[model samples]
Target: MATFPQVDFLKEAGLKADRILVPSDADFVARQASYWSCGARSLRPACIVQPRSAREVAAAVRALVSARVPFAVRSGGHTAWASANTIGADGVTIDLGYMDWVRLPSDEEGTGKTVNLGPGNQWGRVYSELALHGLTVAGGREGNVGVAGLILGGGMAFFTGRYGLACDNIVEYEVVLADGRIVSARKDGDHANLFRALKGGSGNFGIVTNFRMRTLPLPPVWAGMTIHPKEAIPDAIRALKDFTDDMWSDPDFKDIVVIGALIQIAGVEQAPAYKKWLEMPTITTTCKMTTIPQLTMDYSQAKDYHNTWFTATFKNDVRIVAKAAELHDQLVKTLKAFIPDGDFVTQCLFQPFPRLFGQHSAAAGGNMLNIERQSHDGLLWLAVAQVRTPEQERFAYTLVQDWVHAVRQFAAIIGGNLEWTYLNYADRSQDPLTNYGLENILFMKDVAAKYDPEQVFQTLCSGGFKVSNVKLPN
Candidate 1:
């Protein structure tokens, strides 16, 4: 219903009329309606701009700034937050779906047979394309996740123990800054500081157009899922803790254990211990050696419901896991009693964050996550609430917040509390950037100020976590 003043400016700046879609266009309506989360789908941007190249993105950015209109950039549109990658009424949205391109570079010496990825490409497509070459990159564990948003938010992968977080594996980034400058940022290049900040910095500095990441051999991996009844939760918690404790000795093992209404352990391994562990007293699914693309695709089915996520981190203590599992049961009971007919489901996942993950990041030019500073092995906990309607979504949000608070309090009581929060799994209310500690927060602020002096990203591009709110230490 609102007017978009920037439409004329964008057209005059060399953006073709066919590239811009207004509300009347069926394509624009379809794109706005199809989001991974219901909250993002409810927003209505004035117009959508589909830029096919970085130059077009630069022109759009310049036009939007000159017109002084609010805008948001969307890659895969997977973020759960309401307005994260989508814009509200009276704003313009720069959708990068048309820019989805994946290729291998000709100069493989300096870049080391790396894969060039567009921000618009999903992890599923990237893996499928690279799998043809017998190669893979450390990326999102879920195939449907977008390349740009996940990398910007510090991506976690099944190969994190072996290769590190997805952002750490990136060798170069082609970014379009707030002032319309296109630049390549690398570790040893002129924008080295910007390069480090972009790792786990959450789109605060610039809009990343392309990512060149180091590829690893795509050998067959032993991967599968193991499901257990509700009564087996305590055993699952104990096993997870034991696995985290032993990961220091054997970094080849990677698994994600969910302890909630039902217990499931999905993992990939190369050691014999994995097979022995699979033989434990529980119902196990088919475990076989498979390719990375197949393994990721197995878990890529999109949930047809409203989803919300909140996260926490704690030391790898069996007590913490047990207590969280107990709390999860109570939370589910309360939700069922309040919203009896609502199709609300809760998922609590515990992922291992061994010291090896940090070591890998350190080896590959340090990132803003600063996971290396953690002295002990830990677990990153993600609590997701899925509902069928708006009313259920409201209740789910409150219940998830209470659940996170109770877990943090219990951890503090046991002296096992941790300060870090994984950015990719964080909710809107949680400040994952500030949780990176005072030093990293200050460094991010400096990078944001240096590259974007006018704070265009902090102010105009008002999606995701912003560095402007990070406070320095006294």
Candidate 2:
């Protein structure tokens, strides 16, 4: 017998039966299975609430908070972390995937500089819709990443070189407060503190329903992947060294080398910056002039894997990159010994993170990433291992942990370590909030208390990087 009171309370709170799903419901099973991570899919939420509008989300929040039920807010449910979006049978999941709408501003809405996005939207659909008007926003680089998670984590976008992070470009957030009050948090508004806190502070303040984001003109881009052979690693590394900024390099763990790219040089088919990489040999090259939406579709991944990911930041030194690759080899060896075949993919990606990005953020209402503190260019390094089965997931977790530790130690030895740990790629075990610095931490805490007096989001709303978990003064 399902004894979870959340279902009844949700119904009593005016949410339609169709909007709520229990373990007994077939749609509930399908909804749970829809999460990108098999680990998340395995969990059993007592009921999953599919809120189609802000008012519906508010009602759910009110019911769940009043009843003292632990709940989680899920947007797109793309993360591989088990508890990130899904909860145990004791809780409910506020799956916002149905609220996936995008709209350009009418004359009555604010300046045409911004567009409204639903929290449930995935970047690919968002990009495709926006591209219809020859426009886009500084959103997620990967198409499948949820708009909410990416923006809340201080998103790294395709146009980060010219603009800043996805968070930096947010003009306003229509957030449902802990007390079920719907409010708009914007730079020019009365709730300005909450506005900044929600940027990089993550899903601790409120459940955002609509994201009003600054839009940019999307032009044709010269982009795509270029796969390198195993023997060309040294040469590829050289080319990367010479390049100012390129697509994130994802060399496969199998050691059959690959350098997949989705880089864009706006308004031109070819840029001199990529000359070094273009000169190198490769197995496959998809580099061509294409739209951002088309390029993003090419980068979407299959959701059938048990995944473990960890990240760290370091100086943009070739030694650190080389050391990371060496340690990745060790990790791959250990993982193969444990799993011994089947489907497994590992990546050691180093994305370009320049310090000036912070300046760009500051110019546009600012974000909490705090990477601007670094006066030089850096690399946001991500180590990912996706495999089959829970057993493989556990083993891969340990292996990836060791690899990240080894890489950090090597960075320390070479004095190549940096402070910022981007929340988007961060593992659940990591504390990316503290990396935002003391000022930002204090600012977020104050905002959390002011907006959520009872600390509903901090205490009851489970999942995501919580501001309550930090040791800083509240």
Candidate 3:
């Protein structure tokens, strides 16, 4: 095992002694070994540095860069890929869990309120905290997801139909650049370009220490999950398409449909479609007129299993969705036959990415997703599988890869294939940044060069998708 060369330097510097944990320390061993998703739990870093503030993070960055040692920054440890948030054997891990802070500002001018959040905070805590003040921000549907990774990678939320993505709600970002400089990027600030790049650019630019997001009033929401048997897939597909097609006119309806061994529909219940879907032969779990915090709390899934996610985007066509359902059924059978001993379950989810979502973002400051450039409203497809062990992961990966390819082919056949991909749900094997469209990719590269001229983030970060690998158009 390789050692972190800057461990001693970081300790000798102003960093607190207790904050730096070596592999020998029990706390370090536990934090290093634990991950929200099992796929990254196997990675072991040489040392773990928990920074309590952005200044400490900057100090750690300076020491690591001076010593030329590789390091990975982890916010919530929710990424499912190995080494995506966890460091390899030779690297150091900057765990920002201690920086979890959420507060409402005392001074503000507008009709709405803005909440300040720490990157280390989880969406569950943020939503819960803000709900006390009768406010909520656009955030991940799943509560356990971290604020930093999701916002940086273009987040999707139930409120995305009303507001845009989670990133679109960000008013300011306090970031630590490659040169160990801490700067604030706001829409009207000098670092505006960097601000836009950070919207969907992943971890390639810099480490965001803090996020200040605009919050909406906490409205009473009616939401829940409905389970239908496999026989309902065709009807479910048609229903979903009809709902999404109508979303342009009806912006209040938000839904996420999952097709697999069973069909699951989870979303806002106020939509008439929800009532109609509930009428089908199904097991319904209903939550009516609740706050955002309570809704997310109710829908939180278990994180104990090894998870894999792959995603694709296509036009909102019922034909394509039906084809995807067939592929999902076939993939489940193949997984059972290949890995009978593994505890594996598959999920194929379709969510509306209506043109209205993009229009909302455009109304706010634009983002790197460039959804406005797309010609039509679409559905974002995610193929997810979970297993219990490392050995099972291999079989799960192969199964998911094949399923994604089949879905892509189906979309192409229907002339509905979309170049855009939702980065938050994409697997490591997929190139989501390149699919952001050629112009956005080029703009992101320019921003990377401008903010990190030494290519420190591009070369040294070594986690998440890097802008350097984006392919240029011919």
TM-score of each: 0.94, 0.94, 0.94
lDDT for each residue of candidate 2 in 216-285, tens digit (9 for 90 to 100)? 8777677777887767776766665545233333211001112646365374554556666677776888
Best by lDDT: 1
Q: What does candidate 3's lDDT look like per residue over 270-379, in tens digits?
A: 55645456656776545455666766667666777888899999999998988888888788888788777746767788888888888988888788888977789899
lDDT of each: 0.82, 0.81, 0.81
Candidate 2, superposed: residue stretches over 4 Å from native: 1-3, 108-112, 245-262, 265-267
Clash count list over all predictions = 0, 1, 0
How far does residue 143 in candidate 3 sit from its true spot (Å)? 1.0
What candidate 3 gets wrong by more than 4 Å, as runs, is 1-4, 109-112, 259-270
Candidate 3 vs. truth: CA RMSD? Answer: 2.7
Ranking according to lDDT, highest score first: 1, 2, 3
- Superposed Cα deviation of residue 163, candidate 2 (Å): 1.1
